[model samples]
Target: MDNHFVPKLTRRALLISTPFVLAGCTTASRETVVTKPIVPAEYLAMYDAVDGEPYPVDAADLTRVDPAFLRREVAYNTPEPTGTIVVDTQARYLYLVGENGMALRYGIGVGKAGLEFSGEALVQYKRQWPRWTPTQDMIAREPERYGPLASGMEPGPLNPLGPRALYLFKNGVDTLYRIHGTTEDWTIGKAVSSGCIRLLNQDIIDLYRRVPPKTRVIVLQGPASGYGV
Candidate 1:
């Protein structure tokens, strides 16, 4: 046993070993993209093959889909760090930012005119097959529609929140809005929800699995074609 013959890491050795790290910084300082992440064709194809629904999705229901509502990946240059969820309320598009100026885009249904919610929030919690309950305001607006469900509706394939729900919070309080799933895929790319942000059930389920609690979400107004830098 040679107790005193320990390996040494010299400054020159460290510098030589990490030249690529410093080169990356230099490349970034130049403000030109040297490399970018690309979503593979096979990876993109998986979204179309989502199956094993709790109950079969109506074949007729799936056939009427508008092409614009399909999930996609796009070049999204933003100052926001990777993993931030940016919602363009006016555009009816939600972007999940990722590395090297790329994003996963989802078509969504937003709050109807007066019910729009805007600003920054954090994903406080999430659920699978979440329960549904109309807010008091909803009950007041349409007692006949929501009065019976105020206590909370049980989780099911038909729940308005659908297969997944990402509860948002601002300043440690519930925002009363969710980035949630809905079975009504046709509603996507339309502004027709009561007040919540809605996505296709399959899409939300995919998103829920990707984003964790504490992720920052920015809800923005205006028709910004892509995220801002």
Candidate 2:
């Protein structure tokens, strides 16, 4: 008797099995899959707030709130007691008066009372990350302070006004004082500006979007009712 035994096999079975082995080898040699990086949802939300535009790295950097930070507690909702802004230079507060004698109060940084004005004005123009040009008087008063930029300071984080600015006008002439954002949040409730009203960057950004061009603005020397916070 022969020690070896022969087994029958189909040609088709051998052909089908050969290709599967080859397929395994081919698949192993193929490139790995790659995916594009996705931006975070918080960043997307911030982008949407700014008209869905990506932050301009070269233009200016605005102070951004940390998405994780807890918002400050307010006794009332913002856009509070909505009326109009009444800047009281004497009290160092801007009141947003609401109905029924209710008011939303916000601390403000005001200019020296002597240098400030009181009257009705309107928002004639607005700018984003506006340029800072020191007036001739500003240069003369503090040459060392502004000597670095004889021409003017271009838009940037360091600029006195952080991000947005609203130009106030009376009749048809510019008042030369602006309601704008400030890098110095600590200055709120104090007199530190040169006849301009300053708000925190975040606060001003919120206000800028709400107010339209030609909105009535009144600067009052004394406190007034119907102010909005």
Q: How high is the CA lDDT of each candidate model?
A: 0.73, 0.57
Per-candidate TM vs. native?
0.74, 0.60
Per residue, candidate 2 scores C-alpha lDDT tens digits across 113-206 of 5768679887787788888787676678789987777698888767876678888899899878888877664576677787888876655665
**Candidate 2: how many backbone clashes?**
8
Q: Relative to the unseen true structure, what is the C-alpha lDDT of residue 191 in candidate 1, on a scale of 0 to 100?
A: 91
Instruction: State in Å the error of residue 229, model 2.
Output: 11
Off by over 4 Å in 1: 1-62, 223-229
Residue pairs clashing, model 1: none
Candidate 2 Cα RMSD (Å): 25.7
What's the C-alpha lDDT at position 142 in model 2? Answer: 82
